[model samples]
Target: MSILSGILITLIFLGIFISPIIGIIAGPKIQWNNQMKDSCEYFDTRISMGTHFPESQYNIRSLDQSVHDQTFFLAPVFAPQADITAKYQYYHRFSGNTANTAHLAIDVDLENAIWRMMELDGPDERTKWAAVGRKRDNAALPAFENVNQTVIYNGTIEQLGPHLWIPDFMMLIQGIDDARQHCEIEPFIRVFDVQGAPIEYYESLIQPKWNWSPEWDEYLMMRTASFGLGRQRLDMCVRENNFRTFEFEEDKYKGVSDISFVPLAIIASYRMRFSEIGRLDCSKDIMDKARDMI
Candidate 1:
């Protein structure tokens, strides 16, 4: 090849390599930020969809229909967003046959389950579990779409029978007590766009009928971390006779919740501000016009 032709090719290759650097230098002067429309407008569009919101009459049912030994409920305090919903389930001892004492546990969606699975299994060991699922149906679980009328969170809580009592606090369960006694659980309600990005986040506090166990503190913390909640070990903690164990591992308590139902008070408290999580149109472009000194 001629020297000039070879030199031209070399310069072309060099320019390609340096173009990214040049763009980086020039990027600061160019405003690439896309402008989005008002978030409230998006919420307004979603509200126009006309879906049923949470009402005072919360529904509680059994995750396990066969036995129905234990009952659970994920009663929404207010109207949730179309995409995002807040669910709360606890163990109910007043349901079915206690002869077998079988606990029915609910599971989170596959995606969240995989995350917890990875957390428990070290990074190195996760690959094996991922490969374990062979069937297509058992493969990657589908993302939660428009679950119009289904409760998502499925953790259980057990009310300590009026037997055990500690002077320091309203001690119902031994070996597993936390400061959550009579604590107001204010769950942050987040609404996500079609792209799975959260567009709006608000708070709604559920008034506790009874003090929750310390075991649930972590569960509550994790549930509040996302607009979409997941399932955990929905077990029960009961006050057997005069003594109470940290947590009851019996099968009957699985998916069992024991939160008391107070219709009027719960409805009143929830109506304070967030009565309904309005929907929004995430299609518009909004921009931040702030000047950064840096």
Candidate 2:
């Protein structure tokens, strides 16, 4: 090769080798002041399409009937541009179960599951869960969408229970509890029939959830984390019962949750800890599920 060509090739190789070294030595990242989004929350553990968003799989929007359980879905972040009808349909707990223990004990009564919600100038002053003094008992602000809803069937007692937008914020959970309990630790709600009314007590309120999608299975919000945080454990501290022990991969970080459910109050006062986890199976994705069900 000519001397000029040789020099060019040698310089190219050196540039590749030296760039990384310079980056590490000169502080790779710029440190900036922390800013918090008071409006929205970022969840550490993502929901697995496998996790029951809606209480019954039959309600999930699926083209195929037999494979409803295999449908891959997660609660979509409320994007103004996205179609609300389709996107937000993924995360909910609606049950048609007529059994006495409805919605897996996550819900006992539909209307009163959550006592109140934190929203600015929410419509429906009749809203049961509005925070009274934050915005106002009278100030009129634009209505913000909350993913929580309870549907009572038209002509039947069997109705779908409500599972609100369960934001994965344990600290927020504590704040909510403090508002109600006022520094007093109370026992979880022990559901029992009140005056012949059957009440269901759930052992757990939340559990770790995850999602995975292969490169070939290109779909919205299904792609694995763009940054490729592979094979992470969805660490969480959710309400659970004394009988069950939540175990993770290889028995690592075993038994980190014991929070029991508080009926009629979605954000109750007993949850404290970040010990439970649902691990991600990075080896396969939606393609694997589709093929297996087919």
Candidate 3:
């Protein structure tokens, strides 16, 4: 072939051979770039933070004092109706008191305060693993084996029915009280997040279901809180680079002797009321009301 003809033919062949490869290679890169850009924009337009808890030393005494004062006034708010027979009967089953039933009005102000601190610290920076530490020898059955084989086997089978009868009830009551108190204090936390645009919201995806009695109820309540807070914090981390991801550390709170002050995880999912680009205004009324309630 003539020089020009050969050159033209070669150019044509090169274009045909290389074009598909170029397209294949560039396709994923282009898509990835677009996704990265979109993600960056999504996070940039919204405020988010990693999981974190307040680093300040938590004062249990102060929290207790606050609870004492608040409960003193609020106790009357939940005052038993003139006829508390029904209420008494309901709790009597749990409390095991037929006469002069014990009234349990759990105060959750401490829980709220702890949660607020957690929110302020953000989820990204907080530790994930809860250190349960060493619990008292509270196990009902001593770690002893019966000499009689039949009796040992029967005892094992019988004990399988329910493990947490009383503790579960206590935890359920505590969780309910905690949730109510959290609702009361939510407004304050909103103010704390005012500077940043609201983080991208996600509906709570985790739910607790109860199949057993007290244990089921207690587990559901605790799981609800943990999953709810975890979802919220995860979304925040995804939306805004401010919050840290959760990393569970084993046995960190293991030595803690105070059962009441044991560390607990919080999880919740929320949706942004407005688009990321939308304007946000803090509500003074809400803030004021929350402060007053506190």
Q: Which pairs in model 2 have colliding backbones? A: 53-92, 54-92, 55-94, 116-129, 117-129, 239-259, 240-259
- Candidate 1, residues 188-242, lDDT tens digits: the string is 1211111111223101112223332223221121111101112111111222112
Model 2: per-residue Cα lDDT at residue 272:
13
Residue 265: error of model 1 in Å? 6.6
In candidate 3, position 192 carries an lDDT of: 12
lDDT of candidate 3 over 1-294, digit per residue (tens):
599999999999999999889778776655434433322222221112222221111111111122211100011012255675423221100000001111211112221121111111111111111111112355243333222111100000001121111121122212222222343222112101111223331011111221211112111212211113112221111111122112211222211111111112111211111111121122234545556999
Runs with alpha carbons beyond 4 Å of true place in candidate 1: 1-54, 66-255, 260-268, 272-294
TM-score: model 3 vs. ground truth:
0.17
lDDT of each: 0.23, 0.23, 0.21
Model 3 poorest ten-residue lDDT run: 150-159
Question: Which segments of model 2 are wrong by more than 4 Å?
Answer: 22-294
Worst 10 residues of 2 by lDDT: 269-278
- Which of the two candidates, 2 or 3, achieves a greater TM-score against the reference? 2
lDDT of 2: 0.23
The Cα error of candidate 1 at residue 10, in Å, is: 24
lDDT of 2 by residue, 105-144 (tens): 1222222223221112222222212222224566666455
- Clash totals for all candidate models: 23, 7, 30
